[model samples]
Target chain A: MSRIKACFSVLKESHKKALIPFITAGDPAPDLTVDLMHELVAAGADIIELGVPFSDPMADGPVIQRASERALAQGTNTDDVFNIVEEFRTKNDSTPVILMGYLNPIEVMGYQHFAEKAVKAGVDGLIIVDLPPEEADELTAVIKPLDLDHIFLISPTTHGVRLDKISEVASGFLYYVSLKGVTGSNQLDIGAVSEKLAEIRSKADLPVGVGFGIRDAQTAEAVGRVSDAVVVGSALVERIAEHAGNNEKMKKEISSFIGSLRTALDSI
Target chain B: MPEVMKNTNIDSLKSMPDKRGHFGNYGGRFVSETLMGPLEELEQAYKKYINDPDFIAEYEHDLKHFVGRPSPLYHAKRWSEELGGAQVYLKREDLNHTGAHKVNNTVGQALLAKRMGKRRVIAETGAGQHGVASATVAARYGMECVVYMGAEDIKRQAINVYRMKLLGATVVSVEAGSKTLKDALNEAMRDWVTNVDDTFYIIGTVAGPHPYPAMVRDFNAVVGREARQQCQEQAGRLPDLLVACVGGGSNAIGLFHPFLDDKDVALYGVEAAGDGIETGRHAAPLNAGKPGVLHGNRTYLMEDKYGQIIETHSISAGLDYPGVGPEHSWLKDVGRANYVSVTDVEALKAFHDLTRIEGIIPALESSHALAYTAKLAPEMDKDAIIITNLSGRGDKDIHTVAALEGITV
Candidate 1:
């Protein structure tokens, strides 16, 4: 079994929900990313999502957009991100790392080249936000044999036949965008998310990880009950943005925040 | 069927997209899953209405009455003589309602929105020509309209912003990445994803996901259709060459699509080379950039080695974008059309020459095409006829030109 599947199976056996902490690679500083990934794992993150920053991240809210801008300013590239993952793998191999971002960088690298590099770098999964299942054939064909899970997102608007199509192709876990708006938007109705999660569970057998607009321990705990995994991005990145000048404080703050989310999910 | 015959063999050109909207590895529906349903619905609706006689009739009728169709194909006699070469003709898209060729696609999208029972329409703009066009059609059809424009563009093209507001559009200034057309496009896509139920997105360019590039091209094909007939009657045969400026490539593709099969007519697409292509500050994707996916389709983009989009610079706000349309990418790959770049100074000179020689103040965006024509015209014999798409009027660009000349106005 793949690292992601094994990780999920272990969580399922423990009857515990997964906590995924997302951070942009090369944000604040390029050299600090591998450290942050290790930090996230130490803080009890079940899965680590490393964002490959792009010039334009349309689906992201302001916080993540700033994260990307910072990462890009630091002159981070696809190889740098892969190197970060590779560095993390040198220290910790069990923790599954998912590379999340837009599709252009991977396209430039060529699908086969990206998949080969990603597998070698120990990337467990990919969450290309802009590439839907309908258009994922080229990348999917390349990544499928390499044991990299092609993770897909299901939004509030996805329903019926479209939902089935997305669910069919999705592997590892299906990311459920908790709200209709982009990340960092304030309005997330937990009841609506719960309802959607229920519907999604009925259709797809894969574990569902909920994200977008998820902030604070209480909300994470509430969301943890409804889904198999709670994916937290903007809230953690906002802390990094806040303490960006001081690397030590940023690391501590992110660790403490993810620790709180881990604690909250464990309590539930 | 006869329409297909006037060009080259229809079978080769018409069989494109192949149901999945792929224009030979360029165009595809590469959007988020939330948008899949809406895009699929849009595709279905487009497929149905594009063939419906009643729908086509209504579209044609509106083109004739509202947009003032068959916009004149004027022979630029004095300009041709001055250039001392090819006899040049201008497809006068500048005379369209709302002062640019943008209205052609906007009107088509608005009518489709009405038919789909959408109560509101949203659009993104850089120079605000498209915003004004979208706003005009929204008001005409009595639907709510919102336009997203770059905050920087809002300041530069304040007159067009006022015009959009006057036409009943809520102009939302985007302060995102680069603060320009590409940023406005991102914001518009966000809005459409958020409000998929009641809103219709009217993409101004032939870029975006799947159906948009093809649909916009089809709507604006009137430019080519009329020009083809006019060339036969007025010039006694089809022109030897066709030239147009390409930003997201709506206007260029509009004129180039019908002529794709025409073997005799060579096509040239001019891109904005801000200072020059060598300066690394231009929007000439085909000339200086590589293929990368952005804003829903695979196309040539101004990106760095890391795949981050490079900031594009151009004197014409409309052409100041990082990517071109997917079809243009395919055309470039297949050698169906040639892509070139013109610096701001060259385009500005063309802007002045056309005004003085032809008594027509062309938009700076359109002036890029004129600049290339000026270069190509001098090389060809006087009997050679070249048709250039005069995409817009220069009225909205007066302030920009004035600022360039160190004038307060």
Candidate 2:
């Protein structure tokens, strides 16, 4: 079984929800990413979603957009991200690392080559934000053979027919965007998200990770009660952006924030 | 190359987008899942209204009265004589109500929005021509309008910003990456995804997701249709060459779409080479960039090796974009149209020359096409007819031109 499937199976047996913390690789500094990944794992993160900084992250709001800008300014490429994952893999192997970003960089690298490189680099899954299931066939063909989980996003607007189509091709977990807005935008209604999650669970048998506007521990805990996994991105990245000038403080702050959310999810 | 020739059939060229919006491996709905429903709905609406006679009649009536369609194909006699080669004709789209060809697409989209019972319309603009055009249509139809423009563009094209506001549009200044057209497009897409129910996104250019490229092209194809017929009647046959400047390739595609089947009529799309393509500061994506997905479609984009879209430069704010329309990419690949670049200095010279020779102050965007014509016209025979779409008037660019001359104007 793949690392993601194994991780979920372990969590399911323990009757524990998964905590997935996302950070843009090379944000603040490239050398610090591996250490941060390890920190996230230490803070009870079951899965790590490492963002590959794209120049135009349209789906992201101001917070994650700033994270991408910082990462790009530091010259973080796909290879650098792979290296970060490889470095993290040296210390940790149990936690699944999902590389999340837009699709253009992978397109430039060629689907087959990227999937091969990603597998070699110890990437367990991919969450290409812009690439829906409709456009995933070419990449899916290559990655599926390599045992790399192809995670797809299901937004609030995704209806019954599209949900069936997405669930058919998606492996690993399905990321359900809790709100109708971009990542980091406010106004996530827990009731609405719960309702949507119930509908999504009925359609797809995969573990559903809820994200996009889970800002604090309470929100994460609230989402965790209903979701198989709680994914926090812009909130953690915002903390990193706040302490960018001081790497030690940024690392400590990020760890503590994730630790709080992990504690909250465990309590739930 | 030989195989490409054998496949260049008129029917195949016209029957593009093939239901799934693939334009020969270019153009697809690469948007987020949230937008899929809206885009599918839009595709159906476009298919419905685009064929419905009542919708067609409404669009045509607006084109005639509001947009001032059948914009004259004026013979640039003095400019042609000065070039001393080809007889040049200008399809005067600059004479449209909003001072550019952008209004043609906006009018069509606004009408579509009304037909679909949409209350609000949102658009992204770079040079603000499309913003002004969208605002004009929104005002005409009494619909709420919002335009997203790059902060850099909002500063450069303040007059157009004021014009949009005057037309009752709330212009949102985007300060994202590059602070330009691509960023504005990103914001617009985000907005559309957020408000997918009641809002309609009127994409300015012949780019974006599926139906947008095809729909926008169909709306703007009136430029080509009129130019083709006028050229035939005025010159007794189709012109040997057609030229237009490409930003998101709306105007160029507008003029070239109707003429794509005419094997004898060559097409040229002039991209803005800000300093030079070699200097790496231009917006000539087709000439110097690689294939990548951005905004909503896969096309030629000016990107770094890591696939990060690089900042593009052009004296014309409209053309300063990292990507071109997908159809242009397809046309370039299929050997149907030739893409070239004109430097800022060359476009400035063309702007001046056209003003002096023809008493026409063409937009810097249009001046790129005129600049290429100045080079190509002198090489062709005097009897050779060349038709160029003068995409816009230069009034909005006077400030930029004056700034180049060290004047504040």
Candidate 3:
């Protein structure tokens, strides 16, 4: 079984919701990323979504965009991201690490080459934000034989035949963007999200992870009630932005924040 | 019926960007899932109305009365003589209402926004020509208009920014990622995704996901159609060579699409070589770029080996984008069009040369094509006809040109 599948299955057996904490790779500092990944796992994160920085992250809000800029300013690239994941794997091989970003960097790397490098680097899944399933056949074909999980996002706007299409191809989990806006947008209606989650669950058999607009432990707990996993990105990234230069303080704060989310998810 | 065309057969040139919007391996709906629904809806609307006689009539009616279409194909007799080779003609898109060829697409898209029952329209612009055009149409039609422009562009093109404001558009200054056209486009995409329900994104150029490249091209294709008819009527034959500046490639695609099936007419797309191609500071993606995806389509992008887009420079703000439309990439790959580059210095020279020789102040973007024409016209046979797309007027760029000469005015 894939690491992601096993991770979810174990969580399912324990009647616990998975906690996914996302941070841009090489953000704050490149040297601090692998340590942060280990810190996340130690803080009770079920899975880690490490962002691969791109110059233009259209789907992201200002917070994550700043993270990407910081990472890029540090000279981080696809190789650096893969190296971060590989380093994380050396210490802890059990926790699934999903690399999330736009598709161009991987495109430059070439699909087959990217898939091979990703699998070898111990990356468990992918969440290419801009790559819808329609344009994904080539990449999916390259990654199918490997153990990597090709995840797809289901937005509030996604429905009917489109929902079926995405669900059919998506593996591991379906990330449901809870709000219509980009990450870090303030408005998130729990009622709307739960309703959308119910509709998504009806179509896809895999676990549904709720992201976008998820900020605090309370909202994470609220999302945890209806989702298989709760993804917290901008809130953690915002914290990282605050303590960016002070790596020890940044890691400590991030650890406690993920701990709160984990505690909130465990209560559910 | 193949979803992706590998080879550009002459017969298939006009029917390109197959059903899934692939111009060979270029141009696909590569946006996030949230945008897929909106893009599909747009494609369906585009398909339905583009063929409708009512939509065509309405679009034409507006073009004739509002935008002053069939802009003259003027013979630049004095400049042609100065070049001393080919007889040069200027497809005077610079004379269009709103002072550029951008209005051609904006007028059509604004009409579509009306028909689709969208109450608001949004646009992204670089040099602000498209923004002014979009704002003009939105005002004429009584729709709420919002334009995303880079903060840097707003400073450079202050007149057009004021023009957009005068037309009642809320100008949003985008301050991210190089602070130029691409960043404005990114912000516009985010805005569209957030407000897709009530808003229509009037993509200024022939780029973006799907239906846009094809649809925008069709809207602006009137340029080629008229230029073809005009050249045949005035010059007594089709021009031997067609040249146009390509930035996101709308005007060039507009002129080239209709001439794609005309085997006798050679086409040239002039990209902005800011300093020079070798300097790594230019915006000539087709001339010196590799294929990558950004802002929703696969195209030739000025990106590093790591796939991060590099900031492009051009004397013309409109030409300062890292990528070209995907169709241009396909055309370049299949050898349907010749993609060339001219430096900012050359374009500035053309701007001055045209003003002196023809009493025409061409936009810096169009000056690229005009400069290339000066180079190519001198080399061609005396009887050979070269028609260059004068894409816009240079009034918007007077400040930049004046600053270069150390003159305040």
Candidate 1: the clashing residue pairs are none
Give me the candidate number with maximum DockQ. Answer: 3
The residue pairs that clash in candidate 2, if any, are none
Off by over 4 Å in 2: B1-10
Off by over 4 Å in 1: B1-10
DockQ for every model, please: 0.73, 0.80, 0.85
TM-score of chain A of 1: 0.98
Order the candidates by DockQ, highest first.
3, 2, 1
Error of 1 at A196 (Å): 3.5
Per-candidate Cα lDDT values, in order, are 0.92, 0.92, 0.92
Q: How well is candidate 1 docked (DockQ)?
A: 0.73
Q: List residue ranges in candidate 3 displaced over 4 A.
A: B1-6
For candidate 2, give the docking quality class from DockQ.
medium
TM-score of chain B for predicted candidate 1: 0.97
TM-score of each: 0.95, 0.98, 0.98
Estimate, for each residue in B1-409, the C-alpha lDDT of model 3 and write its tens digit. 2122245443567888888999989999999888998899899998999999999999999999998988999999999999999999999999999999999999999999999999999999999999999999999999999999999999999999999999999999999888899999999998998899999999999999998999999999999999999998987899999999999999999999888877778899999999999999899989999999998999999999999999999999999999999999998888778999999999999999999989999999999999999999999999999989999999988889999999998
lDDT of 2 by residue, B55-105 (tens): 999999999999898899999999999999999999999999999999999
Error of 3 at B106 (Å): 0.5
Model 2, residue B19: distance off in Å is 1.4
